[model samples]
Target: MGMKVRGISYYDYMLLLFVGGVIVLSFPANLLRVWGVPFFRGPYYDVIFVIFVVLALCNLWMSKDSPLPSYYFAATLLLFSTMVFAIGVIRGNENVIAGMKYFALPLIVYMLLVGRRFVLSFYSSNFLWSLVVGSHVFCLLFYYAFLYGRVYPGIGVPSISFAALFFLAKQKYFLLSVSLLVVLLEGKRSLLLALLITMVFMRMVRLSVVGRLIYTILGIGILVLSMYLGLSFLAGITGSAIVNRINLLNPFSGSFDILLGSSGRAGELLSYFRGKDTLELLIGSGSGFTYEWQLGYASTQEGEIKGYFHMTPANYLAAGGLLGLVPFVWMMLLPFRAGALKESNDTRTVAFGLGVFCVVQSFFGFNLATDAVSIIFIIGPMMLLSEQRRPGGATALRSNSLERTS
Candidate 1:
């Protein structure tokens, strides 16, 4: 247990570096621009990304055994991604390589978190608490920026995952309340909805009738208060009457419209292959081909906007076609499998909830653009694999063969 860095026993140093990378990546890029901090710009983020990738590769090579099924599945997915990238390269899709860098770099971090021993040395309650605190700091910073009418690009998925982990730890619900408020203010309706579902599920499974009753009452009160406060802030910004702003917050106001629109989009995505040749339909337009197929944001740097399919399955199908879609789908599901195999009941609950949340979110959000979110979605549940063995730990096979011989 004498984990050392230089002369100091700094086993947690890897954890510190990982958190630092998250913090650096989550820094308000807009502020850097306003301050003319060229040194803290894009390449700074890339440097940290490169460092983690190198570290992950090193750890992977040195790892004696894979800790989790998600690790193996994720590695397989990464290989499939590489094959897709190779397809793009062969076809001379010149920018495919550049576009994939953003998608691939975060994945390296995901791999490191799951597969690296140093990072996973003590992924217990204390580790979860550290993540929760870091997430709260992240949430607070993002909210303050929003209050000032400055929208900085950052991910709330980590905050949401941390909140889920907090519940799994059976802590007082104070942090959950704060997390909900921050997410509401951030206006990520999908994640907010997922949080609501997760809370309901957690309450049903973990709380008694009386506890659930109290939770329900408190949750309703919090929901109403959050809506009121959120609308008031928006009213202040838009100079709209308070009453009118409240109307805009109506839960049912656009439900039907959204459902219809989403359905229509899903239909369109599914039918996109109608006129394509069999080869194109099976192999896709090519990896990163969505760049030519979709729209880009005006403010995003030229060539930086990864195309969006608005649906996860569609995105994969369009990018990798059938060839790339299978492993991607399996990768998404492996979290649930990993969770189911966990010994802890709470781990199973959280892993399944987070897995469902991520799957649902993918229906509405773009994957490549939300790299931070995707990382949490993949690795959050994957943490459950820390205690698992590789399918009877090398002796089961011998035992089975012996039985067969008999």
Candidate 2:
């Protein structure tokens, strides 16, 4: 039997610690920086990640489970990273280390989780719910008590879209409501859109094939109508910063420039591809690629800022071109493969929902492969998927042993 502590398995606590550490370190690290904490530095976060990885490796080493999925994922990431590194070397990129860190960290986290055997039971779900909700509560308190009504996007919490979907899939309405409220108060357009889409999706997926078709048609019409009417209504509202920001998106203005100009992403995308030659366009400029783009929307400073694109497509295109983009897209769509969505179990459903949310939100600025904390949310579900694929649904012996000890 696995070791137990206070009626809970040591392995379960380790997983909890891993998840909690990411939640604390990712967005809340910003809070630490504001408070002048030295531990907010990159090395500290790296240390936590390293510890978790080492622990996971040890567990995998002791287990009798097949490691084929882990090997395949690691190989794929190695190939991609190698290509990016080679291109960076050839192009003499100075920020290759930073670029590779951003590109490889999430993939490594995913690989580690997918390679392991873990059970997502009631205890796991409750632990995740409490941890995520507790973090949001603390962030909300800090936002109101310290920031004095100023909205700092992602200030104290990483993207909660995956958690929100998981809660919704499990019919944990209270947790789902709390997650939605947190996202709504955060006032991130992309995140709000992603959560809303997830809510709609969970509802639609429960319907029959014909019902889903009808729902989609009706949803599109209602969504369009709502956008048209809501934008106009919201534009006239006063004293709300989020509404004021929403007012800027005037889709009826008959000009793409007006709509896309607000985010400056259009300008960034254009500048990214403007001068690329055929070969450079095919394979990209590699990691650490930077381009000059006007950042008029920025609050702190405005002008030409040289850095990576905020959009995932632009980032992937600039880093790995079609080779990177195709695989990235395929990875995002993996949760939708045959038998994935057919799982009747709530835990598996949560995983399926998270995969869908990740795909939808990728278009809006979330990058699972780049954000370490955000990627942690997908790990459990993906591992569950891997387990389900095995003949006779191989049980997670570690988790079972731990349960027995408990």
Candidate 3:
């Protein structure tokens, strides 16, 4: 028999440790820069990437199972990466390595997860709950100790959002509230939107077919109205920065123009395709391609910078063109595969909700491809899918369920 620790197999325990390390190290390095902490930068991510790739290869070597749908998802990402790299070569882009790594990171993680024959149940594991709570505690201490309670985007928002979804599915209302509060403090609008969408998905999945159709029709109008009233209330009490962001939704104030102007997405898109030939448009300028955009006063002395677009659609289209965009969309939709959705079990539903959260967040600026925090979103659901395919997997999952606390 395999060695076990506290009833978990040695390999499963190692997986948990790997996930915990990723969570700790995945905080935005830019935030640390403000405090003069330079340790958590590019090389740290490279180390994690190397570790994950090695684990994936080992798992693949040990497993003898047939290919699953998640494997196809990984393959698609690989294909997208290959296409981007080839186009980069043709264009002789010198920054291809930098661009290709973004796409490759997700591919390797997905492969690592899909290769696993067994995975711990995220819903019932006490270890996961403790890990999440511990991370949040550490975040709070760090904020108070180092940053003097200053709030900025990317203070573990992705990991906290994932924790929130897990807690919500488990009906751990208190922990969910804490997670949401942390996310709000981090000040990421995308994470808030994702949480709302995932909550709706969780509720919808439990209803009957007809009930879901009716709920969908009614829910849209209610959701919009509630959001308007809620945001309006929040604007009154929140900081000016958040209030300014909320004001971008006001159509009466020409919010669309303000948004487009502020984000520079429209200008970026126009600049990207203005002079491209048909063939170039079809396959893109490759991964390392960059465009010049005006910068805010705080950014640089030159008043402009050259970089990739922040918007996912714009970035992917520029890097891989139409050929790359299709697969990116497919990879995002992998969580909704029929087999994963057919069962409404708590574990499956929670995994599904996290998947939805990531997909929704991807549109705004969440780089599912490059962000290390995205590992949970891919791993959780894909592991469930793998379990579903294994014989007696459902029973095994049921047995793994145990009471957990904050």
Candidate 4:
């Protein structure tokens, strides 16, 4: 299965698939509708999901052993997630399938990646670097398109920027600068704060003194250059008023309001918590059952659009209750635990940082629950899981030995 095409290995192909799929799939479906394009219409909406699933199943079938941790925490998390899915099926929540497409698909893809018997070791510099470059290019496209009006990217911008930064920091500073510009342009205060958190974390754990100093200068340069670039386009495209709308000082305040807002799950969570019995608080309404489809007030060319509040944790808690929520939170931590088992400190830190970034981003957007951003979530942690296996672990040991001698 690890055959080469010309010179490129099957491992490289899968890496490409993971990176490319995330970028292409992140394009707003609403953009296609706005243009009335028949592209990717109908049953093809899940194309990205299908690609990952097929690849995952192939890898899983061929895999000699499981990549899953045998720890009690890992067991507890998986069991809870399974119970949530089963309850959703029992409750006849049609959207459970959609949730599977988003959530479960990534989980499968991640396991396949971390396992042996398919693809290269995740520790391969080639694989890691390619992912970094690919993500940086996507971030460039995201901002450049927004600047020139080719697409309307939204909410998850800061998370995407920082994720790229995690990879870029060790490789290329220029790409990181460009990505920082994109995050600035996209203008989500919550995500911006998340980016800051990631940067601070990286500075504390990952970077050497020289690396930190370089980044500090690069960050200042990026800020100055981005301002010039943005101001030049202020009147025509980069809309300065949008920046005014950003309450940078009050980033988390809005999240609190959303929790208290009538339009969202805040009230529902309260009612469910105050239930007459304890089991009701324990089980939740069932997966994908909390939110209902409703008409949106914003009228598009297709008429009044319809959707639901997908504020992930709240919705998941409302649906799966604590039964679903606890496991979901644990699953988020599993990557870090897996990474902790890796001997390479840098690799472990990067994997854990990626996990932190994803978890933080989830609060403002459903990036972890959506196919596009799930790619980011899946690749980083699974790469760490790959480290615990054979050839990959061997390579890491060699590198560690060389470093000790040096």
Find the candidate with the highest lDDT and give its number: 3
Residues 1-406, model 3: lDDT tens digits: 1222344445655765676566654444445644556565456657766787788677666554655545666667778888888888888887888877666766666656653323344544545654766676676667767685464433545777877887888788988888888777666666777788777765665667788789887888787888878866654544465555645554433332543423544555555566778887787888788665543323442335455765676677878888768766775766554235324466666666766777777776636666754645645565665665677766555444333444
Q: How many steric clashes between backbone atoms does each model show?
A: 0, 0, 0, 0
Error (Å) of candidate 1 at residue 265 is 8.9
TM-score of model 2 (CA atoms): 0.80
lDDT of 1 at 371: 51
Q: Over the stretch 1-406, how does candidate 1's per-residue lDDT look in tens digits?
A: 1222222123225544565445434424434543356866567657655666676676566554654445566666677678668777777775786657644644665655553322222222333444555555574575565533453322344344445444544554666566566655544455665566555444333455677588878877887787666645544453433223233444433322322324234434534544577887677755566443221222242334234466667767776778767755665664454333333455455545555555656666664334543555455445434424454422321221101011
Pairing residues by index, what is the TM-score of model 1? 0.62
Clashing pairs in 1: none
Give the alpha carbon lDDT tens digit for every residue of 1-406 in model 4: 1212233345545655565444433434433433345764543456655666676678656654654533454455456557667887887876776655544544664544544312222322333334444554565565456543443333333334544545554555665575566566555555665675555554333456677588767766776576556544442432343443342222332322443222333433343344336665568655555432222222221222222234457645655667667645754554444344444565455555555666766665556556444444435454544454556574543332211111
Best by TM-score: 3
Candidate 4, position 11, lDDT = 54
lDDT of 3: 0.63
TM-score of 4: 0.64
lDDT of 4: 0.49
For all candidates in order, the CA lDDT equals 0.50, 0.60, 0.63, 0.49
- The regions of model 2 sitting more than 4 angstroms off are 1-13, 24-27, 33-44, 48-65, 70-74, 119-124, 149-160, 203-218, 250-263, 295-305, 337-344, 376-382, 391-406
| Candidate numbers sorted by lDDT from highest down | 3, 2, 1, 4
Off by over 4 Å in 4: 1-21, 24-45, 64-78, 92-96, 114-163, 203-239, 248-278, 290-309, 335-349, 372-392, 396-406
